[model samples]
Target: MNRDKDIYVLLTDTGTVLTKIIRTFTKDPLNHASIAFDEDLNEVYSFGRKNPSNPFFAGFVRENVRGEFFEESMCALYRCKVSQSAYSGIRAQIQHFEQYSDLYKYNLAGMLGVVLNIEWEREYAYFCSQFVATIFKRSGVSLVDKSPLLVTPGDFQTTPHLELIYHGKLHDYTGCEVTAAAAGGSFRTA
Candidate 1:
C-alpha cells in the first residue's frame, strides 16, 4: 500500500477529538496552531518548524505534516517514536535496521498495516453501534435496557466510584416483545 494511504488509529477515551486534530494537521500545509482556552491572550501555539538538532520536535512535525521538505536522515528519528509505541523492542529493531537496510522496509510495511487495521476496526465499531441504536429507535424500543447486561460482583472489578439509580425501568419489555415477534424472535417468560 502507498504510504499516503496508510491510516493511524488512536485508541483512547478521547479518540474522536484526537483523530480530528490529527486530520487537521495532516490536511494542511501551514503550521497548524491553536490557542488554549485557559491561556492568556499574549500566548499562541506554533507547530511545524524545521529543526535538525531537536529529534523529538522534528519527528512530531514530520508525522503531522505530509509532503513537507524534511531531511532524509531525520526519517529514522521521525519513525522512532511510532516504532517504540507499537513494538516493545525498539533498540533491537534499530540495530537490525542498521545491519540490514531491507529490515527497515519490512518494519515500515508491517507498522503501516497495523495502523490501518486499527483505524478500520475503530470506525467499524462506531458505525455498528450507531446502526444498532437506529434499529432500536425504529422498532419503538429503547436502546438503554434495564435488565443489566452485566451482573454485580463479577462485573464489579473496580470499586464503585459513582452510582446512579433509575426510578423506573429504562426499557419497556412490552415494546421489545412486539418488536422481537415481528423480527422472528421469541422471548421466553417464566
Candidate 2:
C-alpha cells in the first residue's frame, strides 16, 4: 500500500438512465464514486454495478474507466495524500471486502437516504460513496464528519483534503494535467 503516495477519489457520471435520475434528484453531475491507489487510476474500487451494462445485480466492484461501461463517463478526479499507516489500513480494508465480495452486497436501501436525508446502512453492504468514505475513515483519513452511509459522490467535494486533479470525459482522458499513470493497479479478480 504505497503509504507515501496519494490515493484518488473519482466522481463519475456514466450517463446511464439511473445516473440521470440521480442527477435530477441531487442536482449534481456526479452520481458515483470510486477509489484508486495511485494517480494513474487504471483500476478503481467501489460498490456499484457489477455488470457494465446491467444496473441491477450490483455489489463491490473493481471498475475500469477505459472499459465499455465507463468509456462514455464524465469524471472528476480528486486526491489525498495519507500517512503510510493509513494507506496500509485503507488497502487492507478494500482487500478484505474484495476477498469475500460475494458475502457483501450493495446498499440499495441506503440510496433512499440521499433523497430522504435519513441515515441508513446495512451490515456487510454499502453504496459507492459510503464504501469509499468508510475506507478513508477506517484508514484514519476520514473524508468528512458526516455518517458514511449518508455520503454521496458530491459530498467528497466538501472534504478538506480532497484535491481536484482532473475533470472530463473518461474516454477522452489523456493525462492533460495529472499524469494518468502509464500503468496502475488493475481491477481486482474475484
Candidate 3:
C-alpha cells in the first residue's frame, strides 16, 4: 500500500431495530465502523452482523457498499493518509482475523461494558468499533486517544487526522470519489 493513496474508514447506520436501540444510547448517527484497503472500498472489513437479518450472529464481516444488502443504510465515509508500513500492518491484522474468521465471535460482553462504562475483551471476539480501533492501534496509527475497548463509532468523528469526506446513502456512494471535493487527492494531518 502506498502512503499517498487514501484508505477509508466507514461508519454506517444500518437502520435495523438493534441499531435503533444502540442509537438511543450513543445518540449518534453511527453504530458501526469498518476499514477499507482501497478508496473505492469494494470490500470493507468490520465486526458486524454476519447475517444482516440477525444482529446476533456476528464477527468479522466483509461489507459491500453498493450491494443490495446495504440498500437502506446511511454512511459517513472518511479518508486518512497513513504510512505504507502502517497500512500494511493494518491490512495484515485484518487479514489475519479474516483468514480465521470462524474462530472469532461477536463481543456481546464488550457491548455490555459500553453500557456499564467499563472496558473488557474476550478472546478473538470484538464489536464493530473496537475491531477497527484495535487495527488502527496495532498499526501504530492512533485514531483516538481513548482505549480501543472503549472506543465507539462516533469517536472517530472527532479524530483530528481523519478527513470527513462524504455522508450520504450507502447505496448512492460509488466509492470512486469518496472525497468529491479533493477527488483522488488526500491530505495529511500534522
Alpha-carbon deviation at 173 in model 3, angstroms: 1.0
- Candidate lDDT values, in order: 0.22, 0.81, 0.81
By summed lDDT, which 10 consecutive residues of candidate 2 come out lowest? 181-190
Number of clashes in model 1? 0
In model 2, the runs with Cα more than 4 Å from the true position are: 1-3, 174-190
Candidate 3: 10-residue stretch with minimal lDDT: 180-189
Q: Write the per-residue lDDT of candidate 1 for residues 49-108, one digit (tens) a residue.
A: 225333223111112111122211110000001222222232233233235432111122
Give the Å error, residue 81, model 2.
Answer: 0.7
* Candidate 2 lDDT tens digits, 1-190: 4537688999999889888988888788889999998667786899888887678889999887777777667788888888888888988988898899999888888988868989887898898898999999988887987888888899887788888877766665634333334323122111
What is model 1's C-alpha RMSD? Answer: 23.7
- Model 3 Cα lDDT, one tens digit per residue, 1-190: 3346567899988888877888888988988899987766786999888877787788888886676667667778889888888888887887898799999998978977987789988999998899988998988889999888888899999998789877776655664335433343333333
Supply every candidate's count of residue pairs whose N, Cα or C atoms clash at under 3 angstroms: 0, 1, 0
